[model samples]
Target: MTIDFTQQALQVLQIEATAISQLARFVNDDFNKACQLIMDSPGRVIVSGMGKSGHIANKIAATFASTGTPAFFVHPGEASHGDLGMITKDDVVIAISNSGETGEVLTIIPVLKRIGAHLIGMSGNPASTLARLSDVHVCVQVEQEACPLGLAPTASTTATLAMGDAMAVALLNARGFSADDFALSHPGGSLGRRLLLRLEDVMHTGNTIPMVPTTATIKTALLEMSAKGLGMTTVVDKHGVLQGIFTDGDLRRILDQRYDIHDTLITAVMVRNCITAQPQMLAAEALKLMEQRKINGLVIVDQHQHPVGAMNMHDLLKAGVL
Candidate 1:
């Protein structure tokens, strides 16, 4: 008999879906209390488990850390040998075990209790040793395993992970954590750059900006555009305030009208009502406005609307926002 991978995959998915759905009924005061404990802890949340549970615990710890909570994963087997020192009195411990009788996890219970760390147990069996020993028990019990043989941890781990996410998000909401706050914690990622990297940070400034005086001939403006390579040049007045913008589009329009580029005044053919952004605005916001307005470039200006910097779609792409 040949094994059907598709059938096995479907069974696993169905089993886990049922397990997670059943968890809805278990959301009660105890769940709220567990969240409160993690939220109130001054020290980090230490997650510990063994085998498959350990892998799930590591992910849960990462989720908590990224969502405003200070958390780290500690392997239970390692904890017994010496890693238990990482748990301080001010910290909270989250222990994971499907059966709640993992020997490595159980070995550290007394030590964690002795060190004055608050214990929160997550297990499939509420009456198991781990749950009974903890200060609070949040049951992640599943009716069945997604594994066809009912041996591998599938549904139980999925449900446990979902419950961990709920805890992290619940606490994040209670703490009034904002996108900016999350960005501070994840400064290297694209989302972080989107939230924290301002237009001023990525825009080309100083001589890199393509500029031309309104009174300049189109031939001179083309020289500035060529020097800057922004494919466009900003037109300004005697006071250096932006008047209009001339791009390759303007050149095409002038040529179609049979006007000589060398003889034409830039301001006469420049595009008015040009899109602009402030120096302090987020790069992501500038990108959104450009995309929504169907434009490819923007001039960054100061409070007086004087052009300070300039950027285009390519700039955003170079900054990893594309």
Candidate 2:
């Protein structure tokens, strides 16, 4: 007996897709009420489940926690052993079980109620004991399981996960959660770095900035660019105001024109009114400007139009903004 793996995989996908689509109907008043309960709670949301449900519960708890709702997962088995103490009157408990008859989860309900905690149940059976006992029940029922044997948690788990995501996102929008707020919770990740890093934080400042007076020769500008290793130098006037910019590209063009690099003034060949950026601008935004303008470097200027700092594509790459 040979199994056509491709056909079986397609069947599983079709079954799960249908299950997710069917879940849209169940996102009615009960789902809104569940979101309200979680939003109003001053304490954390405690999520618990058994077996495969337990794994999904953990992920759901993490999503809630990261999206502005304080939450954590507690295993049903552990809750029975003593972790039930983690629940308090100020918290909301979300219990998960496909059949809604998981022995360990059901056993801890009476104690949770006694502790004045609110119970929210997610189950496939609305008539199950867990759902009946909950303050609010979320139905995660599916027409069938993706498992060919009609066993195992497949489509059911996918629907349950989607339902949890919907709840978390609803609450997140209700609270007006922003990307910056999300970044705070994920400070160690790439998103945090992209949102938090500023141009000033990574730009070469002080003596490291490649700059030359307008009176300086192109040769002097090249020396500054070489010493600073930024491939560019800002040309300032006598009053220290930004006059123009000279780069290696400009040098190549100047050489093609046969300009006297040894004696020609930088002001004669530098690109005047060059693109500049503020120190406070985000590095990611600066990278966008660079790509849009087809430039590799930017001169950081203050309000007085004086060059204060300098940075290039290499600097942004080193700062993880590339």
* Candidates in order: C-alpha RMSD to true structure: 2.1, 2.0
Off by over 4 Å in 2: 1-3
Tell me each candidate's TM-score.
Answer: 0.92, 0.93
In model 1, how large is the Cα lDDT of residue 52? 94
Count the clashes in each prediction: 0, 0
Would you list the C-alpha lDDT of every candidate in the order shown?
Answer: 0.90, 0.94
Model 1 Cα RMSD, Å? 2.1
lDDT of 1 by residue, 66-136 (tens): 99999999998888788988899999999999999999999999999899999999999989999899999
Would you give me the overall lDDT of model 1? 0.90
Name the Cα RMSD for model 2.
Answer: 2.0
Off by over 4 Å in 1: 1-3, 253-255, 258-263
Q: Quick one: best TM-score, which candidate?
A: 2
* Model 1 vs. true fold: TM: 0.92
User: Can you give the lDDT of residue 288 in candidate 2?
Assistant: 96
